[model samples]
Target: MQELTTLKLIERISTLLRAEQRKKYSALGLQPVHIQTLDYLASCNRFSDTPAAVTDYLGLTKGTVSQTLQVLERKGYLEKQQDAADKRSVHLKILAPGQKLLKSITPFDVFIKAEQAIANKQFDSITAALYEALVALQNVNGTSSFGQCKNCITFSEENDHYYCLLMQQPLDQADIEKICREFISVTNSGLV
Candidate 1:
């Protein structure tokens, strides 16, 4: 039998996880894209909560994302607020119901079992390896890293304040932990 490559293994794991996610969310009457949008909104900062960012992150058409957002809003899963500074832009905020739905639909049983089955060090190593692999793939595809602000090359902490050099904006702790569509991977930066 041919041995599985690392890429093949990663693909298999992704497929399995997605299958589990589908099974879990199907019971809640949500499709994968809807749940993915909710998950993204839950983890994204204010700067990344716009429909354009969602479209870019999901690699979906504007119409598709618009429909998804409408459905989510109608279901009371999210709300759209007009940006105070730019009426043309709108922000998507996941509601309490969406948060509750996310909590209920998280497919962590398999991952939890895998963690329990592996040593802490082994799990850490595996996670790091997977992250490295993901980075490589993203680089190859020239795709957005969608990493947390703290992991971006432009992130800085000075005078007890967090800031993003790229966006030229101050970041709070919450923003630092949230994902950004414009994230430039620090690992890919030219720093040793």
Candidate 2:
């Protein structure tokens, strides 16, 4: 059987999910990436690091990250500070309003509502089974196992699980421990 390329799958999913995200978050004048970025900052152990730190962690270009930061800052979602160790570097912290926004219409909540509606409307066991098949394929590709929860895009220390904000899936600690190059120190909730 021919393989379904990763790019093909990602393209298809992104096309659908992006539209959904726009319909929801666009009301708040936010793009899906904006939500992703804010949520990423809120969940970070040390978001008060240089902008380069965020770009590197997200595998995004510095220019793109800088542009997004500007938009976020203008919207009153973030505040920046000069790095103490490096005067030239700037760090970011999500403002209280930003944190509240993230905690409210989270991607997880969206997925749960959609999933519940789909389960209620039709025979969707096939869709569920196909997702299982996709997982099998991912495992075969040697890219499916959890490794490093701390570096995951959806990991939340408050929840203590690798919760994917995009997929809304909860990955076990062992499953995410392997892919955590961007791991930072875990901060207590009281600190925030």
Candidate 3:
């Protein structure tokens, strides 16, 4: 038997997931982009919740992301909060309604069932392989990894507390778990 190319495997999985997402979100007057935006906002760290970050993450034009954000805000899916320290920068906060909608539409059950069907060792192996592939692509594309803070090179644990050496700031549990735009994976050593 022959192995499928990485691109083929990734694309096929993406197409299937996208089709399901489109079907699930369409009933709620949401496009895949909208659902995608909500999902990103839900998982991103505070520093990565801005519209500019969203634009970068989605690889969409600023205008397009801005419009999508405005629509979500107007429809009660999210809110734009002015940054306390930066007068010009804004943060996108996913509201309760958005969370509810996302929960209702997400096919978590499908993923749970899939996970249950797979052997534990096989699941772990597949996850590791996929992560390596993702990191490789991100490196080749020169894109931000958006990895969890705990997995970043800048992440430091002192005693019982967490700190970000890059930002010279303390990090909470929530901060360590969420995706950070400035994440530099620990695997990429020899950096400042």
Question: Highest lDDT among the candidates is held by which one?
Answer: 1
Of the two candidates 1 and 3, the one with more favorable lDDT, higher being better, is 1
RMSD of 3: 18.9
Task: Please report, in order, the local distance difference test score of every candidate based on alpha carbons.
Answer: 0.77, 0.59, 0.75
Clashes of each: 0, 11, 0
Q: What's the residue-level lDDT of 137 in candidate 3?
A: 48
- Candidate 2 has its poorest 10 consecutive residues by lDDT at 183-192
lDDT by residue for model 2 (57-152), tens: 778898888888999999998989887887887778889888888878865444454355345444335444333333333333323323245544
Sliding window of 10 residues with minimal summed lDDT for model 3? 115-124
Error of 3 at 102 (Å): 2.4
Candidate 3: tens digits of C-alpha lDDT, residues 54-152: 999999999999889988998999999999998999999999999998888766444444444332433234545555454544454355666778888
lDDT value, residue 35 of candidate 2: 79
Give the runs in model 1 whose Cα sits over 4 Å from its true position: 120-192
Error of 1 at 146 (Å): 31
Write model 1 residue lDDT over 1-192, tens digit each, in one string: 112346654874575567667777778788899999999999999999999999999999999999999999999999999999999989999999999998876756656555443334332355465655555445543556667788788989998899999999999999988778888876566463
Backbone clashes in model 3, listed as residue pairs: none
Model 3, position 109, has a per-residue lDDT of 47
TM-score each candidate: 0.60, 0.53, 0.58
RMSD of 1: 18.7
True-structure lDDT of candidate 1: 0.77
Lowest summed lDDT window (length 10), candidate 1: 115-124
Positional deviation of 165 in candidate 2, in angstroms? 40
